[model samples]
Every structure is written in C-alpha cells, then in structure tokens.
Target: MSAQDYAEISTLMQAYADGLYHADSKALRQVFHPRLAYVCATPGDELHLDLETYTARIDKRTPPSETGDARDDRVLEIKLATPQLAHVTASMALMGRTYLDLLTLQRTPEGWRIVTKVFSYVPMEKS
Candidate 1:
C-alpha cells in the first residue's frame, strides 16, 4: 500500500474513535459508507446493525467526552489487499468495555469509507 493510503486510513480510523467517543453521528457519517454492515457475534449476544441503525444508536448514547472518560482508541493494524480496499484492526474503550473492531474499508468515489465492521467486546476489569 502507498504511504498516502495508509495515512488516510489511519486518519479515518481516528475519526471513528472520535465519533464514538463524542457520540457524534454526523461526524461518523463522513467516514462510514451509507450501506455499511455492523456485526457482532459473541455467542448468545449477537448483534447486527446497519449503518443508519448504528449511527442512530450512537446518537442516543451519552458520550464519553461529556463524562470526561479517558479515550483509549488505537489502530492496531491496517492491511491493504488492493489499492481500493483495506482491512483494519482497531481497539477502543467505551461504556466500561474494550471493543476490538475488524473493519473493512473501500475507496469509494468520495474517498475511503468503512464498508463493514465486525466487532467484539469484553468488560474492562477494574484494576
């Protein structure tokens, strides 16, 4: 992958972290594809949500930003299968949980956008 593509995707992931941290659905719309798929299949608590539904849920949550919570968002890895597609592994903290997200992104006409997100989370044990 070109350096530019890596940097762009890196920035996009950062935006994702910020979006969730602030619960800003408007900001999320800029990075996520309109028809993106969100899935979580952690056994009995499986979840499947489309882009609009996911964003709507974000809109309804109280933001960590408002709660003064520490933001622990990171991009663990990024792999580009082709010039137009990429896969990212990332982690973020939200609502007392740590989520690991496997994201698929596409280079759309409007630039890179997240097309799918398959994720899982676990409770953040108290230290």
Candidate 2:
C-alpha cells in the first residue's frame, strides 16, 4: 500500500477497534456500509453475518472495560488495486488469543470503508 493508503487503512482500522471497544454503533456505522458482509470462523462453526444481523448484534454488545479487552496492536498489510479496491489484514490480541481480521475495502464517495470482513483466530497449530 502507498503511504496515503496506509494512512487511510490505519485510521479506519483504529475506528473499528474503537467501535468494538466502546460498543459505539455510530462509530461502527462510519467505517462500514449498512450493506456490509462478514464471515467469522470460531471453534464452534463458521458463521456468516449480514448487514442487519451484524448491526443488531453490535447494537446489543457491551463495551469492553477501559483496561481490558481493548483491542490493540493492529497491523494492516494492504495490497491496493487502483487505490479504490484493496485487501487488508490486521491482527490483534483480544482475550487470551490472537485474532486476525481480514477486510476487503472499496473506496466510496464518503471515503475508504470496509465492505466485507472475515474474522478468525490464529489457529492453534501455530500456537
């Protein structure tokens, strides 16, 4: 990613982490589209979440404590195609395990926003 792209991705990723940590729907709404798509693979199963489902779920979440479960150390490695479309992968440690969230973003008139995301942990094989 170019410096400009990197800067944009960093800002957006921070917004994502903040949204989850603070459980702020407005913040989340700024980073993602209302029609966003998501896939999360946890130990139990591979789950899919659409826009409305994710909105409802996020709306119901309790924000993490100030000092705990505040996701940090996000690293975004991005490859951009025309600066409008890019693939980004970021990692952070939440709870006791390291999780990676891969995001696909497309620049819209509003700005660069995530369109789809896949959330999963670093599998145990690496641990």
Candidate 3:
C-alpha cells in the first residue's frame, strides 16, 4: 500500500475510536460501510449486529467523554491483504473492560470503510 493508503486507513481507525468514545453516530457511520456486519461472542450466545442496530444502540448510550469515564484505544496492527482489502486489530477499553476487535476493511469508491468487525470482550479482574 502507498503512504496515502496507510494514512487514510489510520485516520479511519482513529475516527472509529473517537466516534465510539463520544457516541457520535455520524462519525461512526462515516467509517463503517452501509452493509457492515458486527459480530461478538458472548458467554451464552453470539451477537450479530447490522449497521442500523448498532447505531441505535449507540444513540441510547451516554458517551464516555461526557460521563468522565476513561477510555483507551490502540491499533494493534493493520495488514493489507490486497490493494482493496485489509484487516486491522485494535484494543479498546470500555466500561472498565478491555475488548479486542478484528476489523475487515474494503477500499470503496468513497474511501476505506470497515465491512466487518469481530470482537471479543475481556472481563477485568476485581480490584
């Protein structure tokens, strides 16, 4: 990938973090594809969320930034499998717990957008 490609992807990833942190649906929508598939494996069942459902959940939540909650987000790695396809791994702290997300991206005409996100939530130890 070219430097510009890397930069654009990085920016999109950053937007994802910031969007979630602030509960900004518009910002989140900008980075996610319209046909996004978000998957998560919980203890008892798995969750499969479409874009609309995800955004609806976001709309009902209070943002960490507004609640004075601490959040940490980091991009672990990004691998470009093809000119138009890439995978990114990221770590994020939310609600005092950690989560690891694997995001699949596709280079669309608009830009690079996240097409799929498979994530696992890590329970924090009691202090």
Candidate 4:
C-alpha cells in the first residue's frame, strides 16, 4: 500500500478512537460509514447497532474526559484485503473495561470509513 493509503486509514482509525474517548458525534460520523453495523457479543447473547442508534447512545453518555477517566486506545493491526478494503483490530478502555474491536473498512470517494465493527468486552475486578 502507498504511504498515503496508510496515512488515510490511520487518520480515520484515530478519529474513531478520539470520538469514543470524547463522545464526539461529528467525529464518530466522519469515521464510520452511514450504514455501519456495530456488533457486540456478550455471555448470553449478541447486540447489534446501526449508525444512528450508536451515535445516539454516544450522545447520551458523559464524555470520558469529563468523568476523569484516562483514555487508552491502540490500533493493534490493519490488514489490507485490497486497495479498497481492510480489516482492523483495535483495543480501547471504557468504564473500567477493556474492549477489542474488529473493524472492517472500505475506501470510498470520501475516504476510509469503518463499515462493520465486532467487539468483545473484558471485564475487570473491582479493587
């Protein structure tokens, strides 16, 4: 892949992380595709969310910064399937839990946007 491609992808991923950390709906919208499907599997069942629902949830929450929580986000890997497609693995911490997200990205005329996100949450014991 070209450096430009990598940079574009990296920027979009970073925007996603920042959006979650700050609960910035505009930033989140920029990084995610309008038709995004965010999925999370828990112990008993699975939950699916579309873009509007996800953004609404974010809008209803307090920003992590306001809650005095330190943000932790890392892009673990990005595997390119083709010039127009890639799969990204990333980790982020929220509400004392760590989550690993598998994201599928597509390159559109606007830029790279996350089309699908499947994530798992890891719980932590309280002190």
Kindly list the per-residue Cα lDDT of model 3 for residues 1-127, writing each as its tens digit. 7898899999999999999999999999999999999999656658999999999999999998998877889999989999999999999997767889999999999999999999988777757
> Which stretch of 10 consecutive residues in model 4 shows the poorest summed lDDT?
38-47
Instruction: For each of the candidates, give the backbone clash count.
Output: 0, 0, 0, 0
- Candidates' TM-scores? 0.96, 0.82, 0.95, 0.95
Clashing pairs in 2: none
Which sections of candidate 2 miss by over 4 Å?
Answer: 95-97, 122-127
lDDT digits (tens) for residues 1-127 of candidate 4: 7788888989998899989989999889999999999999766648999999999999998999789887889999988899999999999988788899999999998999999999989775677
Models ranked on lDDT? 3, 1, 4, 2
Find the candidate with the highest TM-score and give its number: 1
Better of 2 and 3 by TM-score: 3
Local error of candidate 4 at 22, Å?
0.5
Clashing pairs in 4: none
Q: Who is ahead in lDDT, 1 or 2?
A: 1
Better of 2 and 4 by lDDT: 4
Score each candidate by Cα lDDT.
0.91, 0.78, 0.93, 0.91
Candidate 2 lDDT, 1-127, residue by residue in tens: 6788878878888888777677777888899966788898877868898877887787887666444663565665877877689888888765555778888989989988999988887533334
Model 4: how far is 25 from its true place, Å? 1.3
Model 3 lDDT vs. the true structure?
0.93
